[model samples]
Target: MFKVRVLNEEVIKQVIDMKQVVGAIEEVYRLKSNEKTEVFDMVFHEFERGVADMDIKSGHLKGEDIFGLKVVSWFKDNEDKKLPMLIGTTMVFDSKTGMPIGMLNAEYITGMRTGAAGAIGAKYLARENSADLLMVGAGHQATFQIAATLISMQNIKNVRIYDPIDSNNAKKLAESMKELLKDKFLSKYENTDLYDEISKKFNVNFEGVDDLEKAVKISDVIITATPSRKPLIKKEWVKKGTHFSCVGSDMNGKQEIDENILACARVYVDDMNQALDVGEIEIGIKNKTISKEDIICEIGDVIVGKEKGRLSEDDITVYDTTGIALQDLMTSKIVLDAAKEKNLGVVVDL
Candidate 1:
């Protein structure tokens, strides 16, 4: 057995820098893959129904160079302590036998995979001419969303960010991203109340519209990464040809888009069974906002060419992203492969 410990920020940064992770995501759509979305509902009660506290424990048991267990915990209220809102670790095992091989932090992997999912969705669903982007909630996930979008959409010229937090942190994050990209991406950060400023900005026109509605109305591509229990993006706000990538609501009762949106849009889920039971799609079904018949395709189906993505430019599309274990497995494989090439991990026999 061998062991490796990847610190939180370092793993997150590694995930940020790994292009293979994005490639893996693109492959996921091609694998005709199915997601096994599971949740320990009892655990939510222990965490106090807090979006930031919902713990996701998962593992990937198949595929070459992909065998690991991961635990993810979200606690957004701990920022005062300089702690990340989401944190967790992963344990990789040797596939030949049931032996442990290494360990790594999973928080970063989760964000990257979620963001990559958005990018993949945009690649298939967003208009080819889509240029402007609107992002709701500027956090770790938001950063990855920007990264993925920049990589996937070559024409994206401007990105508008809206968050309720103070302007200092938002500006700092934006600046850091700008510097990291060497000014290849242009981002505008605003401290305006989401509801109040929605109408003024064409990219984020929320005026005369509620938060959820306004967010859906202004942009060709809308990415919502909040931890809200109730709906944040409504159906009425979404127009024809709009593409939505929702990453915030992964657990039961946690939803970011209105149920009505699911009813009308060409909805695609990372995993259908998982979405039907615990993902946002499940919540919509339980509330009767959408029927099981409303589902259009799974990410894999679209990737494999088995199902159609956006048939026309006027279609409304939504991709509900419930973080998947295979994502971490693939990302870890990429990192571990790079580490092996660069002699990055300390190897020991146990």
Candidate 2:
């Protein structure tokens, strides 16, 4: 007597829009800050081969119509095998009766929602005049971070990108971004100076940079989205009034920035429970550089007025995100609704 809609990555892409995601994730943060949601703790499992790992993140929406669960995997050999690094799905159900309503490909959703969270974090925590952005990764997640930041912040002048393993990865990111961004502005320039002309016309420049120190030193807001066991960004290179959004440390013992950065920076997290356990904040706490109490507040609390985000323009702020479940759940609600409205997925009787 019922049916469920199934969506794949291609179908999900048809409905993927950055502006909608940013707005939806922000709305969920308010709901969470007011104590109207339940985001469960994440569970991790390692395959026997020891080269692959899976993460399970689930959550419920109070007084809403849907809940979601996201299961994702990271395999070390994926690139070697010519496979996708991120493979996951989102399972959505009716909140009232516990009936399944939809299932969707989650790779894009996970990256997009995480990107939106960082952009929202920047909106409240970064200096108003923040323009230059330094993205320390050139993979799939880094692209989302750049695209979403450009949407959230206006008058941005420069974006500097770096990747450790593949220098070409950064160059490819710049070209892809140019294609994605060309439609946002009107262009009348020659082929030789197309990139510079586009930047001059839009007053924004995004490109790949080889010097990591120079990138960090000149940036107003820095976003780290790489999976690195060692610290990549140093505290000394970070300028005053800079904001850093650490998005890659979703697993235990993974770090992306120098712990000393958190010692001096006014730190914020998506959720204290998760951030203290696995996020970049966990590194600072483990090293005794800073304690949980040292964290200024959760980004959600800043949205609901329970705590302030950044007190001064000169304040150094760091937001450590562990990929909240509520973000996945709420974002899926929006994606599923849009898919249904557009008739974009396959429906089957259950």
Candidate 3:
């Protein structure tokens, strides 16, 4: 009697770490590259207002043995109302038997898997000697970007973080991450271990950058994580051989970089269909600056060695991700499997 499982956030976080999420996402990308999976384009609906706004995004992922539909929301300006800005859920099903398997809270999974995609992209696209990393938006998602990059790129030394919103927000996030690192060190060994010891393993320094040009120019990798409708990063400011992971521009008319960047840079998207529909490159396509022809291939193809990424040391590559459904389904499978083994979720007849 295998009934459907409904899970909680506490268990969700415990089972699916960023490293595992990255691996799962990379595996799913491999499956996609091999044509062993089918994922429909995303369905996004937005309702804008003065102070608060909400949007719904839903999608379907079909793999050889599994598939699912996830519906997530973007609740902007929820801070003023003292509520979470992001809230959503995912339902997973077995492909062979058409049986319901699991459902879960997908808010954290969304952020972690998205950041994992950025990290995975950087692993394939960023230079092997890349060290300087810049975070264009230091919000809740910023740490995930930093964390995943730290895990993926072993040589990163400097982390320059900026939030277009303000300096206080950036500074506060940096402080919290430092606390997290210290706590992580203390939890394993002992409280007596100096923070310096922990820093020895991950000796990356964080700086709050107020100048956007300097932030973009000095880094080997740039990750944008803001909800900006207008372009904030300029083409002339970026350095050669740098990789840009554009994560914030997941909707049509929302962009974070100048169109010229997309015109010349070797572009790789998580999904080419979704990229043209509502990714950062969508505006470029609309303006005739770039089109579907400019895209090299999906990140999955690069991961599976079907496409080349960062062919030369001086090439500039942009990985445009529009938040795919396969990512959510893979992450949910990991959490669901762990929950079933640990008996951690609420089980009910469905």
Candidate 4:
């Protein structure tokens, strides 16, 4: 008989938190730099051009002796049917014995890990005194991006949100962030020290702005989480010391920032090949504004001290991520271990 731990969203939520996921993501990058991880090619497909799509990402961590695959799908019309727009599942295996280990609902994991990615970028690349942040595209992913940044970077004092498509979306997201701080962190955390630390950041100013140019100009850090077909941010509006965590543009032809920004900035990516193919840097490469040699280094290299992140305070740094499969494996490992210790999930024999 073969047994496997099956974890659902509720059980996973009870066992794991964003802080744990953030640590796991940081560890994975260090592993990558050490040549202890491998992310296989990704397979992406569309159902109706832009309406729906799915992607399969598979990878293994040699040091951990585990391999896994994450299957994530996006249905634009699912919200109307009262279902989640994004659904994800992750399955893991023991590399040594070639046996199934566990399976988990990875929708929440996806959001948390992606959030950690952006936060880590800011931690390593952004200026030490970055106090103002601009968030573009106030959608589901935007909440995680904001939460992770606020948790990781204590210097941020103001958060400005802007959405060109709908001003109400920006307003609602600002309200949701306030609720998240009060309900999720202030009242929920069992750790007293964490609660005290989070309480101090509770008074952060959250504003919804209609002027994208003004918001981008005054901000010290900017994170874009939209899937726009063209650029939403212009080059002239950005300052010299601004750090951009481009979370959108995961597919070809989708871009959030102008290619001109890449020409003058120090570019960093999660994976070089994937970034060139589908990440935010793809637009720059296609436009001939930046060449392959212009990329500084992968974030992993910087994490392991093989490369530098920000040479000077005035240097513009951009982190373009394509969502590697190793991230799913590492983050899932955290949830699976926590679930096992707490006995939160059911064990199924097959």
Candidate 5:
């Protein structure tokens, strides 16, 4: 067996840019068109009575680089140390012989897959004339979300970022994004004249939106990446034709948008079972604001042409991203393939 250690951040970057990963997802979505893909069978272990526990989810899919197992572990109250609330690893097997082919650090995979899902959602659901983007969080996922969206939808010209605690972090993120585009194409990504033109065309003003409500109101597409127990973006602030990508709130009790927002919008999810269990949709279900039948489609469904996307020009759309194991497996497959082509990884025998 060959062993490789893929770091979290590096895997995140590779997975974000790899078009093969997105292609794999699109193929899977096409096969499971309009239908909710079968959820992975889960095994739960209780450590303590109510507060402590862990769960392992296992599943299989038929597509490129098929057949895999992802095991995620959850432990609460780890926030004091700045570590992830839940952490684990995933193992991918060779579909032909069932040999263990590779292992990946799950944290990075989760962030990248979630961000990619948002980008895919924006690609299909956002308006074709979309030019300005408003991001609500300045974290790692936010960076990748912008990267994926920029790659998939090449029309974006202005990006407005807002983070309550660290506005400078948002600016730093914008600068880094600019730097990436510069390094890749050898030119400045954002020009002052272009920014001015986009700002005028979109009527966007990032100056006065000190709070979440105002920031969300003006953008064509808004991405909420904050980890909040309470709703951060108000429903009233969301206008018609606005596309919202909820990348945060993958855990229960964490929510970014109001439950009422789901009631008024066409809601899509990465995985229905996972989202209902712990994603933003869980809060809407718990509050009875939206029913189980309210979900429109999965992002994968839209990608594969199984379901309709953006039915109306003025429809309000939201993508509830909970992250999925298949995404990790597919992205890892792409990375491994690339590594083989470029002789990137150390081929240590196991």
Candidate 6:
């Protein structure tokens, strides 16, 4: 009754595939819409204001018979000590027995699940013929976002990356993505095969851009994954029928798009309460530019057919992702299941 499996980042990398994780996330969303899952209120704390912070995200997946919590922290100066700036740990429990079943490193799961969320947003909300994508922010998360997008949306033929802090970051990420697609360089079988097939079939192009406005205007889909506190994209620059997956702004003060965009767009959130508190739409709601009623519905609602996504070709759609706990919980189960089949994790008596 006290045995627990331990999975480190390395083991997690071997067992969890992005394609499977994407499917898991899609199921989680549907479960959420059907009231079969519950995401508890996220608890956030800052070690030092503006320097470091931590968040505890917990949820119950009643349909899956599991529940879990993920603790993620970000330390701005951790690089000075040769530590990753972002670190996370996730604990999973059996719902029926209420016993801890698994513990694992959460960094990879965090990135992949969030990437899937962004891609799913585009899949449901973006125009059917959407081809060009502009990624706003060229960080580690940006790579996963692009990979998941390519895996989910085969129509995307061009990807442009922009980092407000430096153009070099965008250039580096562009090169890395191009190499990844060309070589099918991932360890996961499904992802590797998909990348290889995509590279051979599509003339995919990746570019690093300095002109954010021009990139936004021409792109069919724009995904932002930065940690910016101010708006990096303007409302006037955005064209009609464009879809935006706002992946940043998971904190009280962080923002990426102008609030004016929400005024005219059909906005959807991962969770209404979390979105109003810390998502891309938070600023707009705070400034009275948009109210809670402005949000059409949760993305899960659309996924479950409870609501429509992208009502018209001329309608702008925005998905405000606040990083829900249900995503981590569902993805953890996938990793745990895979690890068990391959006998890839360490088992310890608790």
Best by TM-score: 4
Candidate no. 2 TM-score: 0.91
lDDT (tens digit, per residue) of candidate 4 on 167-229:
999988787778876665456456656877766666699999889999999999999999788
Candidate 6 matches the true fold with a TM-score of 0.95
Name the lDDT value of residue 243 in candidate 2. 94
TM-score of each: 0.79, 0.91, 0.90, 0.95, 0.80, 0.95
lDDT of 1 by residue, 1-350 (tens): 45553434453453245244567877655553534322223233246554456544555534453466676666757787798766777776666676766676776677677888887878777888776677777766777787676666646656766554544545565556555443222222224342223212222212111243454566788887876777766666777888888788776678877788777788998877667767778788987888888888788788777888888888888888776666776666676666666665566665
CA lDDT, candidate 3, residue 178: 62
Worst 10 residues of 6 by lDDT: 181-190
- The superposed Cα distance between candidate 4 and the true structure at residue 208, in angstroms, equals 0.9
Worst 10 residues of 2 by lDDT: 184-193
lDDT by residue for model 3 over 16-125, one digit each (tens)?
66666778888888888888777754555666644344443433445547787787666677777898877788888888887989889988888889889888878889
Compose the digit string of candidate 6's lDDT tens values, residues 303-348: 9899999989999999999888889989988999999999989999
Clashes counted in candidate 5 amount to 0
User: Cα deviation in Å at residue 260, candidate 3?
Assistant: 0.7
lDDT of 3 at 20: 69
Q: In model 6, which regions exceed 4 Å deviation?
A: 181-187, 190-203
- For model 4 the local lDDT of residue 25 reads 88
- lDDT head-to-head 2 vs 4, winner: 4
Q: Which of 3 and 4 is the better model by lDDT?
A: 4
lDDT of each: 0.65, 0.81, 0.81, 0.87, 0.69, 0.88
How large is the C-alpha RMSD of every model relative to the true structure?
7.5, 4.6, 3.5, 1.6, 5.3, 1.9
lDDT of 3: 0.81
TM-score attained by model 1: 0.79
Clashing pairs in 2: none
Name the best candidate (by lDDT).
6
